[model samples]
Target: MQKIKLFTDSTSDLSKQLLNEHRIDVVPLSVVFADKAFKDGQEINTEKMYNIIDENGKLPKTSAPSPQDFIDAFKPYIDDGYEIIYIGLSSDLSVTCQNASLASQSLDGKVHVVDSKNLSTGIGLLVLKAADFINEGFSSEEVAQKVRNLVEKVETEFVINTLEYLHKGGRCSGVQNFVGNMLKIRPVVKVVDGGMILAQKTRGKRKKALKTLLKNALKNKKEITEDRIFVTHSMDSEGAEYLKAELEKEVKGQVIITDAGCVISSHCGPKTVGILYIKK
Candidate 1:
């Protein structure tokens, strides 16, 4: 059996510790500002990105990594006689998956790209599972198939503290942004069928919105797998901790807190917290 190697993009929002521990390779997406471009999680981080956004009052443009980037990342492993499997962010959200596919075509079947159909820790959850299957002696093909099957089982939902970022990113209209901020309306964005949708809107403070998100997640606890869950945030340690503490009381899984990368934070903005897990 050929050795299996795992690859993922920076949008996975996985912590460096997890990436190093699992031996995962990451191709970083670009976070472009009006003045310069930085590699997500490398040249820039969440706090610095947030500060730039605040200073400029503009949301940075995030671009998917080029096909060449994936090719370069996979070439070293292929030369070492390993089959590569790359799990990327949702194709619906970014062209990162498509670029990976293009890169795979040039690798002579040594690479398999899986569209996570989700983002952030939603992708992280699947990548970790792929690592587990590979460690259990599953063939590269088997590991890819097993991870793809779990794509739809992943549940991802986040609460936005403000609509300013959404408006700047063209996801929300200026009027909606104005009204939402005026009313302190927070929307819970959920990943459904490979796209993000407004799952629910809560009118009140951010605390109320976070509680609503927690309630929605717990209501489906029976279906949630007790393996591992991720609490990913963009400078929202308070919200992440609240969700983690509440979730730990109900679910047996380990709740991990991770900082969102620049790519994710550019769109979601600061104080955006998401809970991601695979369902049984």
Candidate 2:
């Protein structure tokens, strides 16, 4: 079997250490703030981006990687005589997947691209699974199929403290005014059918929302196990830690907490709490 290369974009939200350990290559997207652009996860980090947002009163806009960026990332593996698989964020969220496909078209069939149909640690989890398969000496095609299967099995749940951020980001236009008016409403969001969709609305209290997340997650405890539960937060370590403790009490397994990076933190804003569960 030929050597295989694993590729993913910065939106996967895998930390630098994880990426390095897995030997996964990342193509970075751009974050533009007030006419200045910084490479996501490269020149800009989560803390820096949030500080800028705090001062500016608005989050910066994010841009997908250009086709050339993809080409530059993939050319090395192709030249090294290895088959390449580029896993990326959802097409519904961004065009990074399409751009990777386009760039691979010029690589003469040496590269394959997959849209994870999810974002952040959702994509990160898939990439990590793929890396394990690669370490097990799986072929590129086999790893791609495995990633596709896993994508269909993963679920993400999030609770936003306010609708103001979603409204500003144009994600909650229809119900923005109504949801915003009700100070008691805390939006519970989930990734359904490959897109971020509202799952439930509860009172806007942090403790109550955390309990709700744990309650919902326990409903499918059979699917969750020691290695598959992930909790992510945006500038709210305290909230995340609280959720982590609560989740441990509800589920009989260990949980990993990931900080929402620049790409995801830009949209979710600060104090966002979420979990990603994959059924074994």
Candidate 3:
């Protein structure tokens, strides 16, 4: 059997330890400011990006990796006689998946690109699954197909603290942003069918909104798989840990906490918390 290599982009929001342990490679997207551009999680990180946003009062523009970037990332492994499976961010959200597909075309069928149809640890969950299948001696084609099949089963939702960032990023209308902030309305943003939607809204403090999100997640605990769950946040350690603690009390699966990457943070803003998992 041929060797299989795993690849993912920075939006996966996976920890460095997990990436190194699984031997997975990453191609990063870029966050562009007025005068400079920083590779997500590479040249810049969440905290620094937030600091810049605070100073400038504007969100930086985010860009997907080019086809050449994916090609460069895949060439080394292909030459080493390994078949690669690259799981990237949702195509509905960005063009990263398309660029990866283009790179695969030039690589002579050695590279397989799987659009995760999700973001953050939602993508990481699939990458980890692919790694497991590869370690269990699954063929590259099998791993790719299995991951693609599991895409729709992933559940991604976040309780955003404010709509200012979303408005600044051009994701929400100006009037909605103003009214939401005025009324202290926190939104539960869920990733559905490869795009973000307002799943629920809570009119109160941020903590109350988080609790509502937790309640909704736990209400369907029976359907949640016992593999793993991710509590991803943007500079919100308290909220992430709160979710982790609550989940550990009832969940059979391991609950892991992670910081959302710069690209995700740019859109969601600080104090954003999400619980990501796969459904059985």
Candidate 4:
């Protein structure tokens, strides 16, 4: 029997410590600024990405890793007689999973790709479960199937501090974006069916925005798996900490906080925060 190797993309928003501790690998996407590119978790880290966004007052563009990048990552584990299971970001949101699927075709069945249908710690939670299964001596195929089943149950929600990033990135209309910025209308968005959509809106300062986010996103906190909660942020430590404190009262378990990697940071911008958990 061969050992199972776990992998995921940088959009998983998993910390390097977590990845290294689990021996999980990541294929990084590109965050481009002014025609210059940097790998998500490598060349450009989360803090640097956020600082650049703050300095330029513009959201950087994010590109999926090439199929070749997946190939490069998959080959080593395969050559070492290991079966690879790569859990990737949502296909509806990014091309990362699509490229990973394409790259697996060349690995002669040694590599298996799981389209996580999620992002941030949404993908990270699935990857971590797969790793647990592997550690428990489950086969790669079994681990993949179990993790895939958890996809629809994962919940991810975020509130943007400002509409400036979304406006600059063309995610929202300039007129509404301008007005929202003027009036300080922070938006609360949720991930549904692998796509991000506006679930609600809140006006006023950061505290009010966060209050709305917690209420809207965690309305069904009873449904969340009691084992763990993930709070991922883009250089928003204060917000993340506040969220963590709030979430701790809802779920009696571990709440891990991680920085959103470059790909997620590029779109989410600085001072954005979110919570992820699996539904029971």
Any runs in candidate 3 off by more than 4 Å, and if so which?
Answer: none
TM-score, model 2 to reference: 0.93
TM-score of each: 0.98, 0.93, 0.98, 0.95
Q: What lDDT tens digits, residue by residue, belong to model 4 across residues 102-136? A: 89889998878888888889999998888888888
**Candidate 3 local Cα displacement, residue 47, angstroms:** 0.7
Cα lDDT over the full model 2: 0.83
Find the 10 residues in a row with the least total lDDT in model 2: 174-183
- CA lDDT for candidate 3: 0.93
Arranged by lDDT, best first: 3, 1, 4, 2
Candidate 1 colliding pairs: none
Expressed as tens digits, the lDDT of each residue in 12-73 for candidate 3 is 99999999999999999999999799999999999999999899898999999999999998
- Between candidates 3 and 4, the lDDT winner: 3
Q: State the local distance difference test value for candidate 4.
A: 0.85
Model 1 ranges off by over 4 Å: none
Error of 1 at 26 (Å): 0.3
Better of 3 and 4 by TM-score: 3
Clashes of each: 0, 0, 0, 0
| Model 1 lDDT on a 0 to 1 scale | 0.92
lDDT of 4 at 47: 83
How high is the lDDT of residue 135 in model 3?
87
Off by over 4 Å in 2: 173-182, 250-254
